[model samples]
Target: MADPPDLAVVSQPADLTNAWLTAVLGAAVHGFSYERIGTGQVSDCYRIAVRYAPGSAGPASVILKVASADPTSRQTGAAMGLYDSEVRFYRELVPHLGSGPAPGCYHAAIDAGSGAFDLVLEDAAPAVAGDEIRGATVEQARRAVTELGRLHTLTAGRPSLIEAGWLERGSLLNAELLTQLYTLFLARYREYLSGPQRSVCDSLVTAFDHYLALMSAEQRGLVHGDYRLDNMLFGARESARSLTVVDWQGVMVGPALTDLAYFLGGALPADLRRAHYDELLLTYHAALGPEPARTPEQIREAVRRQSFMGVIMSIAASVVVERTDRGDELFLTILSRHCDHILDTGALPLLITGG
Candidate 1:
């Protein structure tokens, strides 16, 4: 495990609470100003509205994500590459897609060899605000499909093709991460769950490494290493054409369809997802022109290929859900129900090996 970035610049959570008054609003920053916007996952976000000089329009207002260097984050430690990978992703990958769902990258810098950094980002709030009330729409899913098609097509044969000197975080998407996840889950659940259900969970965890090894590696291109609806930012349901996908921490190189199945099936309900699943896969196929991998067999295989990854990721999600806000019986019950349903039905049979 590589050492995470040193964020001694702002140590401790209490320091985070008073970040605005201390850092952004500090005397060091000139010509521009910022305020503490909110905390997200492990990082603190700020609305970094800038100001121009005497007669300069300067750049439009932008948002800055102080990349989380919390050693405690699931990734364990942070690296400057965490921020740099995002910048590199926007630089190398976003252009190939042209106008698509990705959020544009603004200026950013991480301490070389240290991994401490902050990222300036294009504002995508108007799009994300819609999630407060409703979820993704059919149209939004279609658009995402088209955008993904562009992604899968343009970078058809580039693995680790990042710019020289730029670090690619999460590039290590090998068997190790999954193995660690399994151990973590088992340790967390040993006292909480037992019996046959626990046995199934253990089997699933153990399969993490096996699947990683058996998986075939395609020409890796812009993989949304963690693809799910929650990562997308959308406008009002009536007009979500301007959806911008956020969260670049997990960007990596791998099969593009992995992102597709994860987004379409992992989060949404089966019926809702089933309706447009074939259509979305077709959209990806169309990118390779009229005669690409468009066969029914090919589509099903790609889906199954990706769905296996989803099951592993779902295990990761389960571990988190099981320990969150304990005593919420309703939530716990729902979690238990989902776990039982999936395990018994082998709903995500990707865990059964031979994938």
Candidate 2:
């Protein structure tokens, strides 16, 4: 395969062309057009339909992800290293783990100097995106946890993965940044939070390092840093692939329980989660293999400690992203559910220090 064209500066729909698509996608594209899709905050996603010249040998359509045009969002993408990490993930890691929930990428490229990039991935349509506000059903939750186990187990304790500079965890949750972001979060969303909600946020923010340290002591693996219902696309009832996990920007190597807790925390409503918590944990553990690294009690504690993940994301993400009506509603949904989980699980007590 020839080196693909440099799309280091694709800022609009018109920048894409048949030649560029053909080179990267390894097929002849007679022509193509694109339409913006999704409510993505940090990047713009397009559904591109290709007009194949009869003998073209590539997919009919693919999803294209690029850095956002919005100034703040683009700057955030550049600063946070999201675009580079995602492009690297598709280029390096995805190939090793074949035929899974993640989408198939025909091409993944990043222009490191400009912090611009592109991803042409299998368009899993007729497969709808999951809604964070609506919450997930038990079956959907089951598939999500099972797939997550597969993701974690595939690279668990792999020295190469743990040592990769690009895959190493970033300072997104550093104490200083989290404290600053938490302050901004409280100020911006204070009107929407109840007393208990405010209290939990305050406790978590004050003890951020302590909580993070507790999680760091556990066994580690691949973590979908922002794992949740919203990042997934569900296939049709009869399709072989049940779910496709998207958004690799937040990829990191960390305790698997982080993803597990974050997913269950934001995904399920407080009541439904409470009822199925044990079953869901066991499901994930079973899929992780019989001799799991963490015991049931350890998993329970980690889940309890990490349940505040949604609250942290709700606070941090809302402040950074270009907010809209749906964004507000989605973040609020995560906040409400996560806050309730913390209170219900008595997680706040874990963050408190003795006098």
Candidate 3:
């Protein structure tokens, strides 16, 4: 109806006011206060506390996600069209998703030209964000993948979903781009990678095209491109949603097991994953409704084939996101874990042989 709030002003605490808040919320917002939250690299996030007028009805607080102010990160986000995808995801997809492990998006807007965007969403507070470095417990792992199944089940085999251009892998999945990316990733993180790990990545680079060629088109669905514990918020209190996944910037239409594989490879210790991954896989498979029937063996093969996802993500993520002590540590852990999983599952051989 009315024009969206200014992206620059809303992110500034000094400039936020009842008028702007009312426009965004579509209500009479009498007062509001906010504090920035999260260490998001591509976007600036804030938790806003609102005081509504007597007759007004809305949430007491909301989470606001805006494009990053950092020039490099902002430019990268713009180039990737990540902001547009997330805004579109909320506007077009969320309504169809029903209740699941995602937040209620009240308002989502994006300027295509500038690649600036904003999302006003339910604040899933008291739900602590999952820690990637520490990895998830078996119970948490089960919950994470099961919720992923719920997400995937809804869109699997749906024509509209499969056909959505913005939702599908664009330039990001291209072999040349990936080869270049892997080169940069290797150059940058070689010190952190072991000799065997480097060889695995080299094989991934060489076999990138063959790997993509092997993916079954029929198995495509909503893949949370960056699905991992760090992007998940696990509920700490009774009222909160168990797992509200955030960061849909990397969302794509691809083999669903890619998300499951990437997550499992990085979200658990190699030993714990070996001990419990089959059961977790069973949990995810059982949750999927029958329409897009998938056998456990077929799913296992998919997971193996897609195992390189975590490695690719580690390279891209480690380079793009602003570096921090915790960030580097987490990236290293992801690289190590994924490498171990690759070796454990004999995924490198599959990547080479395309079996």
Best by lDDT: 2
Q: What TM-score would every model get versus the actual structure?
A: 0.68, 0.93, 0.91
lDDT of 2 by residue, 193-291 (tens): 889888888888888888777767766677778888888888888654789998989998776588888998889988999999999988888877877
* Candidate rank order under TM-score: 2, 3, 1
Candidate 3, residues 202-250, lDDT tens digits: the string is 8877877787777754367777788898888888768468888988877
lDDT of each model, Cα atoms only?
0.52, 0.82, 0.80
Q: What is the lDDT of residue 246 in candidate 1?
A: 71
- What RMSD, rounded to one decimal, does every model reach? 6.9, 2.2, 2.6
Q: After superposition, how far is residue 72 of candidate 1 from its true place, in Å?
A: 1.8
In every candidate, how many clashes are there?
3, 0, 0
Which number leads on TM-score?
Answer: 2
**Model 1 misplaced regions, further than 4 Å:** 1-39, 69-71, 74-81, 91-97, 129-135, 157-180, 183-201, 217-219, 235-241, 287-296, 314-355
The residue pairs in collision within model 2 are: none
Worst 10 residues of 1 by lDDT: 1-10
For candidate 3, the clash count comes to 0
